[model samples]
Target: MDFNGIKGTYDVIFSLGKNCLVADQLSRHMLRKIGGVLDWVESPALPGVSHLLRNQFMNFMEFPNLAITGINEHAGCYIVRDAAYHIFSHHDFPLPENTPTQLLSYPELREKITRRVPRFLDTLRSSNRILFIRTEGTIHETAELLEVLNMQVAGEFNLLVINHAPVSGIVETPWPFPNVCALQIPLVPDEFHDNDYLWKTLLEGFHVRY
Candidate 1:
């Protein structure tokens, strides 16, 4: 997990959640060492663990319908408006069990995550250096995210993509921003979030004494 050293400190660490747990933990680690200077704001962009096979995240982001579709109760996930993926912990339903399906597409659905989208975009625009973490996703998924960001946010930035998925090795990309590092770390399913070696290498690269 040795990382090629780039330049200086990052402005923000934007995470595309397979779940927010990894991001939250990373923020804590940074907080203890670097204090609150680094931003790790929770936004509705990939709010929860998106099951890649069933509800493909690339499809969701690329083709945004703004339509509320059917729910997969077994996965405890529901797709809200603006393509937000929400997975309920402990299999709890957000609404009542027998709530009308049409009621799901009401104005209330749009209001919840709509405000945060612009805020996230604003954050992206303001920051010049970014450490984007795809906690558990593939290269194609990461590529889709880069495409969306390139369209919405202006200017180039130093991007480091630490993708903690079951990828074989370092994969190549066609994006112009040169400092991108797509890590080839295999995801340990049972011990999903804990990766001491990975973080140690990253923190060291950032010049953080861990």
Candidate 2:
């Protein structure tokens, strides 16, 4: 999965300016390349956690092969809440020290969201899903990060990791998963270009065409 959104919020906080446009275009391109589609589901746009989970779960039920990516750590907490009733629910995970209950006031809710993002990612790792995280900083070598992601995605329907910067370093850790692959590249101009490169790379690497 390709990620070209803001950290924590998963929102397209880029402005309408040229650089922002370039970034958005690059994101779209990457999505197309990965044999995936990008959709912007803002937090405010949804009624709440339950609504977001219900909508995504129903959508996935209709398209099991489809994978939803680009959710930040904060947004992912709602996923845990939504899956709470399931047998292998994420609700079993322990909350972090600073996370406030929803019963708290608005400021508390905001603080909780900020603190729980990392915890949410940890919880998400236990689930069977695929989640692509966008790293910070400039684009660079990323072989090491890709290796980590490969292990995380193997067997699990869902995976989560931090995208701290561009892919640049070589993998020093042992590779775990053979099936999953991570593709890292510099940001492009638009979705069309991004898709072209993404599909080409996948086709070459995995013989899978987008």
Candidate 3:
């Protein structure tokens, strides 16, 4: 299960076979080195993370590597993006016309996600038994968010949840408080789950080699 000294790190270079949504996203993530499931496996092992990360789609410890043209920068912690790509790429997907994939730089992404932070904090204040923290960074930074929140929270919501995979579904996590639950209520309807059939339909047409 340990790929400690495996010879698999390489830049990603994949050709556009057919235009597909899931494939495109996977391609983008692979291009960015952020969406491949194997990347998560090679990531530093953290206690209890595998439970939230490993699912039917990406339970593999080591994925077969192919010729790649990107460095895996976030090799420290598993990315939820990769896990999401796994779930999404599992079903039958429909091919689309060739189109450009819109990628957000970390700064742009941070700004967009934080645009509503003020309004969100205002809403969080109304709830008595809950504490909410929302920050935009790599998906794995949920640990840092909780680390800071743990010290800040006095007796707020016993639940400390991080809804990082906004576009994809995530598994349940342990409650911060023994009796309290981590309430990671979504601000908007989860697009991934809301259009599950669409995703299921779109993932069927692609093959993932990483």
Best-matching candidate per lDDT: 1
Off by over 4 Å in 1: 31-112, 137-141, 163-177, 205-210
Candidate 1 lDDT over residue span 119-183, tens digit each: 55566677555555555444555556655656544555444555545654444333344545555
Ranking by lDDT: 1, 3, 2
lDDT of 2 at 153: 33
Would you list the C-alpha lDDT of every candidate in the order shown?
0.44, 0.28, 0.29
> Which of 1 and 3 is ahead in lDDT?
1
What would the TM-scores of all predictions be? Answer: 0.52, 0.23, 0.23
TM-score of 2: 0.23
Candidate with better lDDT, 1 vs 2: 1
Candidate 1 TM-score to native: 0.52
Off by over 4 Å in 2: 1-126, 135-176, 186-210
Best by TM-score: 1
Clashing pairs in 1: none
Model 2 lDDT on a 0 to 1 scale: 0.28
